[model samples]
Structure formats: structure tokens, C-alpha cells
Target: MSKEKESVLEGFKAFLMRGNVIDLAVAVVIGAAFTNVVTSVVKGVINPVVGAFGTQDLNMYSSCLKAPCETNDAGEVVKGIPIMWGTVLSAVLTFLITAAVVYFLMVLPMAKYLARRARQQAAKEEVQEVMEVSELEVLKEIRDALVAQRGSGRNDPGRNGPGQSTP
Candidate 1:
């Protein structure tokens, strides 16, 4: 393969291997599955609760925009403008519920965890920097002490050099 094609393939491989990309793919799959659950809840639980005051089926609720709104025997509107507000309301409720659950259960916790991890990483870096600086300072102090001792020893007549004996 050409170098350009090889590099592009390598880049694509790296992108696929990234954790966030995998996470996003998983989320999409799970979201699709969760949609069925959310729909069931809205249809079974929410609709029944609303049905206490009116019809059990949310799809049945509607408002007449025109003067003579009517539906045929097959439940299809044959004349006038029939605004199906209940269907819209049901959709809105489902969206809100899904959003609330995802935010509270997934997004919020992940955000907090990432924040904590970042703080911990920053603290660890700061400690490493401090340790490096302190180690350097200690090494410098030791060198200075050794130099001072060597200078003092050389000036003193009592201590001899490496090969010289005291006369």
C-alpha cells in the first residue's frame, strides 16, 4: 500500500481503539435498547395514570382546530383539522424521562468521576514536581557541603593531602 494510505489506515485504527469511541458505540446500542423500555413505561404506566381522568390511550386524546373535526370508523380523520396534542405530549414526556434518567444516572456521575480523576492526577503531578525540586536542592546542598569541606581541609595545615604526609 502507499504511505498515505498506510498512514490513513493507521490513524483510523487508532481512532477505533480509543476508549471514548468505544464508549459512544456502546451507548448508542444501549440507548436503542433503552428506548423500548422507556416506550413501555410511557405506554403502560404514564398513560394509565393520565387515563384516570380521561381515555386510557394517549393517542385517543385530540383537539378540534376546525369547526367540524371528525374521524371515520377506522379512526382516520376524514374531515376538518384534528390536532393530536396527546401524541405530542406523550413524546415530550418520553423525551423528558429519558433525558432525566440519562443525566442523573450516567452523565452526572461520569462527569463527577472525571473531575475527581483530573484533580487526583493534578495532585500526583504536583507531588512529583515537588519531589524533583527537593531532590535537586538536596543534591546541590550536598555538593556545596563537600566543596566547603574540601576547601577547609586544604587550608588546614593539620590535615595532609592525598599523597603527602605531615612533617
Candidate 2:
């Protein structure tokens, strides 16, 4: 029926609008932006520190061999290849800086936050379970009392026998 289809569509829409899904989307966007900031920090701040050691930028440090490798206008080497150690050094430095920043600033804090949140959620669930069990126990006690009262033998037409009807 069209009504059933409308209900199903409404339910799906509600599910998508839940807090968890929205929070996840926001986190993803923020995480991407954070990555760009970290990358730029590594390229700008960290690169300069490494460049202080008499290196014409990290990308130019290389061990050359037979010839001072000649490159065409398109930056392509025509004859011999230059052992580009500078590029490798720069990459290594960038990787190390990025790793350190991620570990200290993002990973550590996120881990601690998740651990704390999990502990709090577990405690809340345990309390809820205990309360539910207590409520069920009360209901069971009332049912048992009613059963016992009906089972007790009685001649009154309005009252049931112990655990039985008095019709």
C-alpha cells in the first residue's frame, strides 16, 4: 500500500538523521581539514629546520657519479641519472614529522577520549540492566502473589480459589 511505503520511507529518513550518522559526517570533514593543516605544518615548519644543515632544500641533495647529469627543458635527464638523495631525505623528514604530530596530537588524545567514553557507557548500561532486573522481579512477585491468593481455598463466589477461578 502507499501508506506502508510512506511509513517505510519515513523510517529510513529518521534512521539517516540519527545523531551518530550526523556526528560521523562532521568528524570526517574535520579530519580531512586537520590532515591538510598537519601536512602544511610539516612542509613549512619542519622542512626549514632540516634545511638548516647546508642543504639547498631537501630535494636537491644527491650523490652524483660519472657526469653532472644533464637535464632537458622538461626537467628530463637525457644521459645519466643523478642519485637524488636530497629528495629521499626530504621525504623521510616529512614522514617523521607527520608521524610524530599525528601520534602526539591526534592518536593519543582520541585513544584517551574513546577509553573514557567506553567506560562511562559501560557503567550506564550496567546501572540500566540492574534497574530493569529489579523492575521485572517486582512484577514477578506481584504475579506470584496473585497466583497464591487464587490457589488458597475459599468459598466466596466473588473471590477466586488459590490459583483458580471461582465461577
Q: What is the C-alpha lDDT of each candidate?
A: 0.93, 0.80
Clashes of each: 0, 7
* Candidate whose TM-score is highest: 1
lDDT of 1 by residue, 1-167 (tens): 99999999999999999999999999899999999999999988999999999998888888888968877898788888988898999999999999998899999999999999999999999999999999999999999999999899888899897886888
Cα lDDT tens digits for candidate 2, 68-152: 7888999777777689887887677667766787789889999999999999999999999999999999999999998777565
The weakest ten consecutive residues by lDDT in model 1 span 67-76
Q: Give the TM-score of candidate 1.
A: 0.78
- Displacement of residue 157 (Cα, Å) in model 2 is 14
Candidate 1 Cα errors over 4 Å, as ranges: 1-25, 157-159, 163-167
What 10-residue stretch in candidate 2 is worst by lDDT? 153-162
Give candidate 2's TM-score.
0.53
Candidate 1: lDDT over CA atoms? 0.93
